[model samples]
Target chain A: MTDRDTTPAIEFRGVVKRFGDNTVLDGLDFTVAKGDRVTLIGPSGSGKTTILRLLMTLEESNGGLILIDGEPYTHEMRGGKRVAVPEKRRRQVRRRVGMVFQQFNLFPNMSVLENIIEAPVHVLGLSTAQAVVRAEELLEQVGLADKRDARCTQLSGGQQQRVAIARALAMDPEILLLDEVTSALDPEIVADVLGVLREVAETTDITMLIVTHEMQFARDVSNRVLMFDHGRIIEEAEPEVIFTAPREERTQQFLSAVLGEDTADRS
Target chain B: MSDNLQTLGDALPRLGDAVLVTLQLTLGGAALAFVLALLLGFGSRSHRGAVRVPSRVVVEFFRGTSLIVQMFWLFYVLPVFGFRLESLACGVLALGLNYGAYGAEVVRGSINSVPAGQWEASTALNLGHVHRLRRVIFPQAWALMIPMFTNLLIQLLKGSALATYILLHDLNYFTEQLRRSTQDTFFSFTFGLLVYFAIAYLLTLVMNALEVRAKNRLGAGPTLREVLRIAPVPATAKAGAA
Candidate 1:
């Protein structure tokens, strides 16, 4: 690798995350280049969502240095030892990232527009009018313009997820994390959420780290695909290459199992 | 019967004055308790021992002790320790501290009931702790707290009747006076019971309205106007009228 001034969008070096007795992520190392779209595919409890949560600063890794835009967000070396970053600095780093959850966790107390504009108006210090205009545009992009005034609980799962997408986008984040954004939707509405995401992937250069079960969406939206198993990345390749000709035995086995289930469901 | 009626009529003005004092204590105590409940509730959830321990101690102390004893202590014992309070003040303070402790649990439980995902979403937005609680968590929690708070409020109102023991001359005091003077214990107690019931019922209506409003904000319940709207007459009723 040549020395370059430009920073990778995200870098996790020897990241270790554990929950009680369960070790979720062990000695994980990876780099996502600026503007790259990466998809993580793995079985349940394989730590795919943990990666997104850590990036969003919703969960702190037990041991690791997570770098956002080449600046350490979680910990930094001081006096030859890793020291936790101050909360003030951690918050500043987190501002560059946003996440949409599987549950479509839009604020139920807020309307769709309020949910979208909340962070922008409050955290980003944008004027309400400015945030509202931006929110309306994002709502229109997500095909939810008419539902802007509706309270989030009044929306269907797909609509709520779309609003969540728009809410993340409203922050104008440099990196976006999607953790099974469509998994909660009914099958008929899954496509609608994915369609909005597809548009986002196509039109924007926002770096994306996604954990999704939608194989077709993964193939369409991600430039790179990572296959995880038991807290380790078993394989990494282009989406097409990974889908068509995975080299690792574990990756091939996992793909066949998942695809078999998909085919069985369809048939 | 006429003499009893005349005696009751004569006592009405004094009873009315006492009723006003009772209302003041109930409303004041509830307001103070609400503020204390929110403080202790949030404090109990604090990440630091300094805040959480004290809050726990206060909540347990009030909850474990009897409210009547607390009232007597505040009114009678405090004066011996160079701290004097008026009877009304003592009654309100005792009610506030005692019930506030119970209300704190309601606040804590309701706040915890807000889904974990909501907290994660707020954190993902990079909202600071205060903003997260004020904007995202508390509003949803408020809706959950109202039904429980309504229960606490009614309990607090009934508890205010204990004020009579402290010489506050609230509704119960006048009822006792009426009983002794008229020599009609049954009617005096019944009248006091009816007044308390009426106040509690009114409070229920007010709290129900508040609950409806809060749930309406969450898109869960019908608005008060929608609930109150008269249903259109059936075609059968129209035919019968014709």
Candidate 2:
């Protein structure tokens, strides 16, 4: 493929989302190029998670369009009118992306292996044998091969989140959305989840959009960081520059309020 | 006492047939009710008013009217409108409609109890609405619905006795015949009550087993062997003990 084929993996054009009277995302515009690992950092209710949710199609945008690989997925402009993309076309576009949640929402009725294999076999149309083989490889990669037959509820929270990562990867998505993945983990177990994610970032070219509170993990995995506040990207820069020497006043204030508290708590 | 024994012996075969008929009504009605419960329950949650409103109407209609009156109308009133059904059909239809309405609420509530994250996870996987509900939501919801369904099953069994009013020769009708012949109201009613209790207890055991199995499948409940503590001794250990 030529450079023309290298369209940004994800693009938002004045995207707007609101819940009743409360607007979560307002006229937002951003882009994540192919193979970019971008982390979004903000305080709660600052709309970082809403960005991921809108991308995953779990929530609909009230206004604006979302494009996957430069094609409309959520709303399309046709004949000078905006209409919802048909369900079949939406599914095709959505298959290019996968998401992991804050709650590690593995299918509780399924075993760890089944959880990973389900979407691959059902959505991707892989045969059971093929899906199982891929699932086992993912389970091993996540360091949970022994727990394949175990129920999702039987696993620890960290183990469950790892399985969720494996489940998302099983679909072989081009873009992976992580919404506060480590926020719910115990501090001791948080490192294990981050370790798996770091490995994925090092080994793969998957476009990752991460929303996290783990500053160090963000610094390690992301090439770019976007600081969000009140549904807007307040600052964007390289991880080192953003973390070490943010230019914006709000960015400086937010970093001090967050990192200052982190240092104080640790001491 | 000899005369009483003779009378009892004569009624035993008819009672056996009536018990079979009672079981037929209970089982057939239960199957129909379960299907209707799933349909109306999921339909009630539809985003469209057309689907949701009709489901609400059916659930309310059956739940509001008495089961006995519905049975009477089916058997008696329907004949005037050039529609006639067998007594057994009438009983099963009435029981199915009435109890299905109640079971629909259970299905709806249990589904609602599933965490919202589960739905989001399914959607994130690109699962279609049908696949998401079938593979993800329903299995978890099924475990929650079991206890409520068990309660409804027992109620349905007791209500089947009302079939006697529609001239269907179920267990209750046979009991009345035995009472008239023996002229012993106490023994006749006591026998019927004992039989009903036995059937209900058996159903409870069945439903308990199902609940355990469903919960265990989700890795939530104790397995059968663990609950019963039926671990087998090793051959070597058994030999040493012997």
Candidate 3:
């Protein structure tokens, strides 16, 4: 494909997810171009993480489709009919995607270095030497080079999270999904992890879809910000426009509550 | 009294043979139980009711029945229906089936204890079901399953002693013979009990040591060899310039 004709790295079209009677994603639609940085902001239960998870194919969408590199991820159109692709095909699609979890879901049984190299060595079929070389380099990038040999359980929350980011990057994915990655860390450590992410956003060409509560970080890092509430993107705009002059009433209330915390801390 | 004591004492050599027989039965039965349980546990993961319901039924049926009754059924009733198995084979089969059912639940629960994220993570890496299990899921499950499987093993060992009823000449059988000839119920039965206890305790100790070693190996970081193996090649300007 020509560079100009390259598809957006990720696209979600009218995606809907429901758990029993509760609908978490209500016909959500969005797109992120190659190498773009986007952040999703929302209150709890607003389906920000669900959107990331659906893109990762961790959870299947109940309706509509998620596309990766302009190809459907969860299903395929066979003879003009949407048919569920086999899990093997879905897995191949998933390899192009990577995610960092809010809980820092590093494999508890593996060391930090092993966690970083596991997908590369096993999934990507890279040589162990090559994978490890790449792993240590990414570890250096995340500022956790010294912690490579450490057990996952031994690292502090922030250190583990940094390692997790390195692990996701080791796969060299086209898209990286961060689901409130710093939300589970101590307040002091949150800055350290966010700093690493900010550095990644500056340095890497990978597209990022971040679900975050840190409004200031979202405003600074995001090219575009979408405000979600009860699933749909109620407001979407450039970060400057969304932060300074959101047109929607719901956006104003949400931003005010988040910004009020900063005012309290300063005063 | 002295003659009776001598008679009981002479049978001690035969008890060794019987003890060996018991060990063979127990180990064989336990090995079969482990494999069957793993299969059963994975089979239970099927989403369809047709597959899941029948597996659950089979697991519960074997688990609910007493080992003794099953042993008798295999030895007697199975032969009547033209399934003639040797007594030792019948004993091993019954023991495996009975304990296999119990072991299946342990396997199922241990596999389930693996976080949902691990599955998602494996899927993200493009590892299929067999590879997902062998490389990622089973190693972790193996760690958790060892302790419960050890407990099951002890039960299986105890169950092996029951084979004397089917005339397998295991430890209990020799003990019974010694008791009948010498009428030394106290010494004979007590000796038999002590042997059983000793075997059980030793097996548990070995299993515990294995559990510790497995956990250490799993938790152990890269070995020195692995670390060295991973060290990088220096970038050579001479080759690049050439």
Candidate 4:
């Protein structure tokens, strides 16, 4: 806490991600404060999910620097040039972050408890007993205490997502990335998972970067909502202000299409 | 009948020794093949051209050439270059290299078959490359590899017959002896076929046991106890309960 004083949780400067000749993130810049619940709303291929992926170190930025908790994360400036950090360094820093994928991505080979405890026992070097105790606590938090012994394949998508949330929380990450976490769930099942996310947002001070289509859940959970268009922030404001009184035409058009409302004037 | 009995009795000692040699060659070659398969399998997937290109080339070479020629090169041809190796050594080396090349493809396919999500989930858990592969990736991949490995093991057993051609006496050698002495070609060849089938059946049983165990761990198949029935517990009942 002392070391992190006054430092932003995440800062991106001129970050670029290109796929062949097409650039997805064109020199994007943004900042997220510690403990801020920020929601990214955009059309498809707006590079919203790419931001979360980059911060999790799953995707590399072809250009620019990323800072995590005020420290250089993806890259560092060496002689006025951005150089990617060594993987070991990236790994060490990423231990402070966790992500929940849209697919749940739970290991089918592992039981629910195994999925939660694997990293703690092996990567973090926690004793099996210690890891199990923590995992049980997380399972309790996610409201799946009895499903710990169940195989991931046997569980419902909603239940699996709850377990995935527990698995990510078991690491005790300072920042959490939810990549359309409820998009893959069934309509009714989405509420059950969103309930879990809501509880976590209310309870923990952890910073959250969410990419979601659930506008209601986004409005409910996020402090700030960022509307992206073509790899840049076109508008950003409080959830109420952004959702109700967006300034950008692209944001209004996207919100109208996603929200199915007659808010935007096409003429 | 008398002649058959006499031939069986006369060949028993030599046949017993030959069986031992066959087991040794089978086990040794399989052991070497397992290691090479793993090395080349991971190496072929390596990002560096230095490792991947060479690994691919080696797999192609061993797989492309004939096993008989490999044995000849290691045993007879090498001697001319002053690199003399024992016939038994040559046989093991050739068998291992050939089958290992085939097994390497199995290894690569098994590893690749693990979903990309699994790899990302592993990375998210902050697992290092070796740790991730060992604890997460390999276990699932290993389950997929067992059936293929079982196939290779049996194939290697049959392939061991070629090993005998390089001046190393094995099961085929002893089986041939019974043929010449008894002048009962039908009985001798049938005896050899039966022995080989018996060995293959035993190997399949072992592999089936492994498959059952692996699948059981994933909660996807019949249990090991159900397959092996080592003790007489009720099939559906949990142990120590009834």
Candidate 5:
């Protein structure tokens, strides 16, 4: 591969994560190229969310380096030796990555506008006026322009999730990690948030790593799709192939379970 | 009875002076207690043993000892060690520090009530530790904390009555003097009770109003009673119409 194609926006090499005795992510290896849209599909505890979180530096891996833009996030190497990066430097690195939570973790104390503008004004050192302007633009982009001044508590779940997406966008992050942004919304509200994400995928140069149960949405929006089970990516394919004819039994079982074919019709 | 009334009339002016001293001590002690409690509550959460251990010791020492004993120690024992304090100052200091230990628990409880996710969000945003506390944590803490803090303040107010034993001319002292001079023990002491009740009642009203205002501003959910009241009224009305 050429050097241009070789480099990825996010690369996880032999990543291992454990919570006491239980291993959540075991030797996970994956790469997302610059501006690529990738979605991870897996069972509930299949470690899809952990991969996204590790990229965002929300959790540290017990083993291996997570690289963003060809640099280690949790550690730095000096003279071919591994050393933990200082806390201050890790914070700087984190500014380049933004995440939208499944729970739509907007600051309940703040209005939608302030939620979007907080990091820009404080962490990025943008003036209030500048942050406000950028926030308005992102709000419009997320289709929450009408609700920008509304308190987060006043918004519906989907609107709040859109505001969360706008908040991440306001950071102008090179990579955005989305962990099931629509999963919490009402069925009717899910589309609105997904619509904004679709627009983002098309218009921006930002690389995206998404973990979603919305198979159709993922298949449509993602350039590549990965299927994970038991802390490993059991299958990786182009979106069409992943949706149509996945290789692994585990991937097929996961897809079938989410599609509601495996269980009896309870409803 | 008329002779008793005349004696009461003469004692009223002296009681007035004592009541003024009581107000000064109560308000001063309450303010100092609130400030100290806030400091100690935050200090107890410190990662370093240097900060946390001392604060814990201070809180435990004051809370375990009787307030009156603390007052006596401040007045008597501390003087022997060269920390001489006037009667009024000693009363305020002892009351403030003693009630402060109690108030610290309220502060800690309120701080804990703030969602853990709020702290995680601050850390995720790259906010520095101090900025995170000041900008993100403290405002929410203030809102969650007001009701409990107000209760502590009322307790501090009532607790200040204990200062009468230290020779500070507070409301309780005034009432005692009035009863002794006037021979109207029932009326004099009852009036002092009313005064304290009024002060404490006024504080509750203010704090309740503040709780409402803070809930509205912070978008903290509706009170359980408000939900219950509204919930039942609509359901009962619909049932009656049916």
Candidate 6:
């Protein structure tokens, strides 16, 4: 912990997100050091996915500021006041971040190779030939090289998700957000999908903010785990500390419910 | 006395001219309507109030008013402002504006029918607004809109009958003349009905073919070759493969 550099890779300051009358994230503040894999664990509507959505700019924050690499990402300063930044600013931040959704939202309009290369070719201004070569490499990395010409709809759930991962990786993003990437998979194929992600976590230096219910996968990949409840961080620590010696009563209950175990050894 | 006889020969040529006029109005109005529908449809979804509000107003105004009255206004009243258009032009304008308002709904709804997840995915990919619509969204939506657009095409074809009221000398006009010369109302109108139905049927086929092409692009439904029966049902496909 002492060796951790002072510069933060991602930071939030009193960020608030709301939907209609509900406050999903209320005055949330946190920081992630560079190259940390943090998994957010909680019950449904506990603002775990909301945190990822806010970073991806899929949902606009009602208040506060999010800084990426220690610079303004969501809200900008205008006249000494924090204001919701314009879409242009948010889009610039979004370029460096990639997300894989729970539902494998691959473009049914394109082949597997086309889906991977589309953003790179159109958004990043990469040459078609260059993007295709890189996309093939990513497909190989995700273990889907043979499904290159297959349409997204033709693939099984795990294959589609793997393609989605390949699609996100082709852009070469600095921050990769995984939102229940395997939550929609069948139990049999879930392992196959997670295996790819495990490899990604092991091989890549990309900063990750993952939200998943699979505690074991979280433990295997993440250095830190943040337990959330009702839009606030109830507790956060290394997986070993949180799993084996959860200090908070709420953390213990949640771990028991998700783990389906009675282990509260330090209760 | 011979005028009363009015051989089918003389009347057929005049009817040909009238059929051409009706087609001109139907196709011309259809072209204009499609353009206006696209404009108002995309504009109605604009984030700015100025564009959206006025687009709604235009859609409602054209949809609420009578097509005949709008044609009359363009042809009859515009002269008061010293801007008279040709009668055919007036008919086309009125038909386009009225039907385009309806088509705009088809466009908006079909675009929305594409799943929200697709939009979210495109956003995550950091696609620009136009590229998102062009490269991703509209291709899906275009397939959805074509079926509904087909319905509008038929309606516009029928609505072109209102053109006769503007003295456009269309099929409806010639049919009326046929009744007076032949002095038989039933035959004249029945003939007109059959021709319009034929044209409408042709338009439907054209639209259905377009829909098949679109669906084939998405790999959703049967191929155009299957639907059109051009490939003889792949019973031979196995032989060729072997």
**What are the lDDT figures for the candidates, one per model?**
0.90, 0.90, 0.83, 0.88, 0.81, 0.88
TM-score of each candidate's B chain against the true B chain? 0.93, 0.92, 0.85, 0.93, 0.85, 0.92
Error of 5 at B191 (Å): 1.8
Clashing pairs in 6: none
Cα lDDT for residue A101, model 3?
87
Candidate 6 residue spans exceeding 4 A from truth: A1-5, A261-267, B1-9, B230-242
Model 5: residue A109 alpha-carbon error in angstroms: 2.2
- TM-score to true structure, per model: 0.95, 0.94, 0.90, 0.91, 0.89, 0.93
**What TM-score does candidate 1 reach?**
0.95
State model 5's lDDT: 0.81
Ordered from best to worst DockQ, the candidate numbers read: 1, 2, 6, 4, 5, 3
Tens digit of per-residue lDDT, candidate 2, span A52-166: 9999888888888899899998998999887899889999999999999999999988989999999999899999999999999999999999988887877888999999999
DockQ of 5: 0.31
Lowest lDDT 10-residue stretch of candidate 2 chain A:
A258-267
lDDT of 4 by residue, B47-149 (tens): 8999999999999999999988999999989999999998888888998999899889999999999988888888888889998898788888989999999
Question: Tens digit of lDDT per residue, candidate 4, span A8-81?
Answer: 89999899998788798999989999999999999989999999989988888899889988789989999997
lDDT of 6 by residue, A1-267 (tens): 544456687899999999999999999999998889999998899999999988988888998889988779888789998787777877888898999999979887788899999999998999999999999888898898998997776688889999999999888888999999888987678778888988999999989999987788898899999999999999999999999999999999998898885233210
Between candidates 1 and 2, the one scoring higher on DockQ is 1
Please write out the lDDT profile of model 6 over residues B74-147, one tens digit for every residue.
98999999998999999889989999999998888888889988998899999999999998999999999998
True contacts kept of 6: 0.52
True contacts kept of 1: 0.77
- Residue A115 of model 4 has an lDDT of 94
Query: Can you list the residue pairs that collide in candidate 2?
Result: none
The C-alpha RMSD in Å for every predicted model, in order, reads 4.5, 4.3, 7.4, 4.4, 4.8, 4.3
Q: Alpha-carbon error at B222 in model 6, in Å?
A: 1.6
Model 1 off-target regions past 4 Å? A1-5, A264-267, B230-242
Task: Write model 1 residue lDDT over B1-242, tens digit each, in one string.
Answer: 67777998998899889989999999999998999999999999999999999999999999999999999999999999999999999999999999999999999999999999999999999999999999999999999999999999999999999999998889889889988988998888898899999999999999999998888787775666766674653343223111
Looking at model 6, residue B217 earns an lDDT score of 71
Q: How good is the docking of model 6, by CAPRI class?
A: acceptable
